[model samples]
Target: MNKVLLIIQREYLTRVRKRSFIVMIFVVPLLIFAMGAIIALVAKDSDKLSSEQVVNVVDESNIFSDKFHDVKNIKFKPVKASLEQLQVAAKTNESLLILSIPADYDKKNVVKVFSKKKPSLLITDEIGRQMNDIAVNNSMLQHHIDPVIVKSIKSNIAVNAVELTDTGAKDANVGPNMAVGIACAILIYISLFIYGAQVMRGVIEEKTSRIIEVIISSVKPFQLMLGKIIGVGLVGLTQFGAWIILSVISTKIAGEAFNSPQGSMMGALAVLQTIPFGYILGCFLFYFLSGYLLYSALFAAVGSAVDSETETQQFMFPITLPLFFTYILSVSVLFRAPDSALAVWLSIIPFTSPVAMMVRIPFGVPGWQLALSMFMMVAGFLFTTWVAARIYRVGVLMYGKKASFKELGKWFFYKE
Candidate 1:
């Protein structure tokens, strides 16, 4: 135990003293600001540039738009002569497509639209829908029917879904449901990958430099591995906490600058107001610590077991695939059926629960559901650490020869 504490102190101090640690603790906020500035520039340019679309309107009945609507991106030219004019305009890039309305075309039925470009389908459909509505309203007015009645008939019907139980008290608003869940999941994925890869690379570097052999002479292999994991984990948390602080300060400044009611920082601040913020936060802590610890341990073991970084490629896919699959499935389940059995089971399963449960939390979860998921994640971390420590004990010393899956299995059974 004394050796473990000494190793932990050594590992923590060694990394924290490096220039890289100081740069990392402060650089992320500047990068985030740069990203925001880039996004604003892009948005401003996009707004200034008009979306280009061509319309060859053949109003055979001589109804509207002879000269065209003189928008900067879109130009409307009157087709007085023939169908040939429309076709020519389309071919020459003067227009995108042709819209033909026959002279005898009945105003009572459906409208016809023709477009060569499949990408313009939505634009054409929207135009057709707008024209249809205009025609219908004009016809109704001509007949002296009350427009209010038509308006009432076309009004959007809304449904209210009130939950009887207050399962997700911290996340009550439907507005923040998907966004909050997605943010939490993303935070978990990013945190795990960043920290786990760090652990892997650190192990490889130390082992390659012959530093591990010297350290191993003074410390047990398991103690060295555990200390490194805890130290790196603390570094990650430090960076993460710094980011949170910087984001909050920047957000408040931006919100005050905007002076808008909805404001720039509402989405971010909502994380605090998320009903049952405790559950979501509790899960975030559980999943992040357990998820990263579990994966980092595996990475450390692989690092100790392998001769080089390239050798880890064969094993990384197995570790990464489950997290990726869980995230994708969480997105699908968010809109499809958040309460389905598949979602429920996925949230409870440790391999996927980091993302799946985060996604489900906003929708509300049963007490047993959260408890069971937390328990499984804790158990997974403990079990994985045991296995990793066994492999790490042997792998930290053996070199030149590449380790295999079969060898890793043997390491598990090897005597202490």
Candidate 2:
């Protein structure tokens, strides 16, 4: 245990003290800020450059004179000309479209649109809406009904969901819930690959240099693997924690500098305050650690069996496949039906629980399910650690020969 602690200390300090790690901690946020600024500038310039699509309207009925309206990127130009003349003129400009409303449009209600280029869906939809509104008003007038009174009666419905928990009712908006859940899943996904790979590489590097032989004289292979995994895990936690704090500070500063009372920053801040960040962040930490440990043990075993990083590809696929598959399902499927049977099974399964459970957290999963997932994840890592330790004891001393599934299986049955 003491030796393992020593190894953990060595691993953690070596990475944290590196110049590259320190530089990235500060530089990444600045780059993100710069990128946002560039995007905002481009959006502002685009507004000036954008021109509205002009549509030539030939309203023969004259009753629909004020029906056509101009919106952000669409303009209606009423013309006193025949369809033939308008069609001929439309050939000159691709952006110009011609709409002909015939005299008998009241009976047939057929409006023909002529254009050199196909008009966008937005322009077509808006024209249809305006024409429909005018037709409805005309019909109401003929029937001696007031269209204004009918319009006033239309109402917009807003539904706010609140979950009734044992403690109390909590706000349950799907939008924020999905956002936080997806975000937590992404963090887990990234950290598992980044830090887990670090552990694998660290083990492989030491083995290649024959450092493991000397270290083995003092510590057991299981202890060494455990130590490396824990050390790298702590480093990941530290780096991620720092990044969160820095990002919050940087965002607040940027918000103050760029936002006025009427600016988007104020609106963003308002939205941010509504999010249940304390719960989200807490769940993120739990999933991140559990997911990392569960995978890192397997990664450690892969590192030990292989002679070099290039030799690791075959072994890595099986280990990473579950994570990749579950992440895709979490995004594509779980978001739609979070409480579905498939989601429940995946969340309970030890191999995928780390990512699957996190994806379900913001959707308000039951307490028993959450507890079961956590328990299974802990058990998963323990089993993997034992298996990895067995492989590590023999594979660390191995050299030159490539490992296979058959050999890895045989190693598991070997006496400790």
**Residue 313: error of model 2 in Å?**
2.1
TM-score for all predictions? 0.78, 0.75
RMSD of each: 5.1, 5.4
For candidate 1, lDDT tens digit of each residue in 142-256? 9998777979887687764555554642334665676778878888988888889888998999999999999999888988899889888877777777777777687778666
Q: Please, what are the lDDT tens digits per residue for candidate 2 over residues 5-30?
A: 99999999999999988988888777
List per-prediction Cα lDDT, in the order shown. Answer: 0.77, 0.87
Clashing pairs in 2: none
State how far residue 1 of model 1 sits from its true place (Å): 1.9
At residue 183, candidate 1 shows an lDDT of: 77
